[model samples]
Target: MSAGTIALTNNSATVSGTGTVFTTDLKANDFIVVIVGGVTYTLGVKATASATSLTLITPYGGPTATGNAWTAVPNATLVGITAQVAADVAKAIRGLNLDKANWQQVFSGTGTITVTLPDGSTYSGPAWNSLTTLLNNKAAKGANSDITSISGLTTALTIEQGGTGAKTAAAARAALGAFSTAGGAVSGSITAGAAAGIAVAAGENNRVEINNVTSGVGAGNPVGWTVYRWYTELAQTGIRRAGDTTIQSYFVALSGGGGWEFLRGGNATASGTWTSGSDIRHKFDIEKVKNALASVLTFNGSIYGKKDGGREVGLIAQDVERACKEAITYNGDRKFSDGTVIPNFKYLNTAGAAAAYHTEAIKTLFELVELALDKPDDARALIASIKEQSEVIKNTPIENEDPRKEAPPIFDVPSSEDYEEPTT
Candidate 1:
């Protein structure tokens, strides 16, 4: 609006001004707005503006007045607004910050929204107010995939479910280092009471360790640990695969003279023969047995209860050692009930040591029966030979005339005494 003071006339179209530069500040067809007699009038300019005088389009509308305050403005189509039932929004903000009045007005459907911009410019469809909302939603955690990392969560996701299963920051960071078996890595459990960890090694040469942890402290504290392991091999120790040359998995310990041992829960009942290596090529100094019957008699087998809840008839190791020292073996690994070390456990060779003596005795018994079976045939042959010799003697009787002498000489020699062991 142009700054001015103007004089008005009562019921006249002529209007005059004092100190108002109408030519420089006011123009034709603009409205002259003024208040007179406590009433206001907006008059249209009828002619060109001059330095001191102008004419209204019609007669003065308000009561007659001399000098009055007025403002001149360019003419436009909209003149006034009239509304009778406009509801007043009680919660409407009285004032707005032009810098922050970005109401991201969104409409769901497709329609043109003509906005009169702050600068009085117009657009059919506006794509603004959006920078702020877009910026805000971009930084939000669950708003979109743009959020790369998040924090301050009350729940944790498990590793098997493709998340780091931890509630704390440190635990989450550590769990991220673990892997899955589907990744071609070995996964197994080795745990303490409530704590757990895993060690992953890369290659076969990388040794997996079973660490002996510190012992517990208390009156009845635990002392040691027992490890149970399984393998792919069905056989143990020195045995080879049934149809392959590879040796079976072995359980080797420093004791038992470093020999491999097979351990189990109960007795082994086999469906096929179990043969021990007895090739003479693997042995030496073979010899025939003598006095096997005497050796068999020396073995004193007795029925006794085993310490492990069973009844057995077996020779005592000490008693057998007295007769044959080779039949006994002292165990190198033994301890007392109180953990005191000792190694006097004499384990006997019950399966193999004295078998040779019994076997030799059986062979000798078979040989005697065969000799008795051939004795009758030999006696018959001898009788036939004596008859032939008598016939020859009769044919030669004339030459010797010794029938009476020969008959006298026909007396028999006695049989030999029973066989006995020769004196040394």
Candidate 2:
């Protein structure tokens, strides 16, 4: 609040001031009025303020004098008015009787405002209702209601908003390495193990080994195999072994029951290949395949050049193959030829081969049929013969008995007339 008096130094360019003046009290490009030898001179620029002494851009043109008053000229517009004058003006505006007719003469224009006074007090302008409505629409927080702690803020602060606080604009950035200044190249490598490996870069061949990875192991099993342990053994693109260009990649694995098997990689031209391993054993159930074939094959006596007695003819080799293709369920390795992959039943391939294999296959099929048809009749005949033999044994007489003699009755029955009437 005090406008200090200037004490001119021996040098006309430098002058000292009294009463709470410091280097921060003035800034560059500020207009200052100084009184020297009862003559007032306005300085265009205030170069610096240092501990009550001021160095000016242009020196005073009069004799060096002590106790000369110096005052900083205020800016023209009130938009950026100093906090000191703003507080005083706000106080004066609040003290005015705004409802009086003279107050209307004081204000040339009509506008609403919520005047915040110097003593932390507030006054509503002429349009109190509209001012409050506008203030409500502004969504401005109260002075104390505004956030005090920044712990909840997640966004980076701006330079005007106190910045990151770790570095300054004037600080050298060489410690960060490789920073350019005005198109000049600044180059450096971040070497590893220099400062406890904190800024170390990973090497080209450096690998992070994940130890003891047993993702799919059973309980109490050894922890050595990773989820991709099988994949790591094979090359990603081509074959690994020498002189093996056709075989792209492969992996070998042990079964839970201690059996080993080879797994072939997929053909990119075709669909993927099945996984290789002893645990991947998936065979067509022989019994199930036989049952499925038997259910479709039938013996039609009229089809094979016989009206009454003919060989089984309903199921030809082609029909059996078609039925096998439709019915058979298998997950084993298949021989694929430029066609749809199907359950490979080698016996059902051709008529000649089928007939050859059918002879063997029908041996079992005929056994099933003969057991179903002829065995029941044979069993019935055996049962009938046993019954006849049992009847003959009952009709035939004993070896020591006479042929003409009659057997004695077991007991005699009395006549109805000889029987006396019994009491009721």
- Over 118-147, each residue of candidate 2 has an lDDT whose tens digit, in order, gives 455666565544544455534345588974
| Per-model TM against the reference | 0.29, 0.17
Write down the lDDT of every candidate, Cα atoms only.
0.52, 0.44
Best by lDDT: 1
TM-score of 1: 0.29
Top candidate (TM-score): 1
lDDT of 1 at 135: 53
Residue pairs in candidate 2 whose N, alpha carbon or C atoms collide under 3 angstroms: 23-49, 263-276
Candidate 2, residue 418: Cα displacement in angstroms equals 99
Model 1: lDDT equals 0.52
Candidate 2 residue 240 Cα shift, in angstroms, is 99
- Residue 300 of candidate 2: its Cα lDDT? 19
Off by over 4 Å in 1: 1-135, 138-266, 287-291, 334-342, 363-424
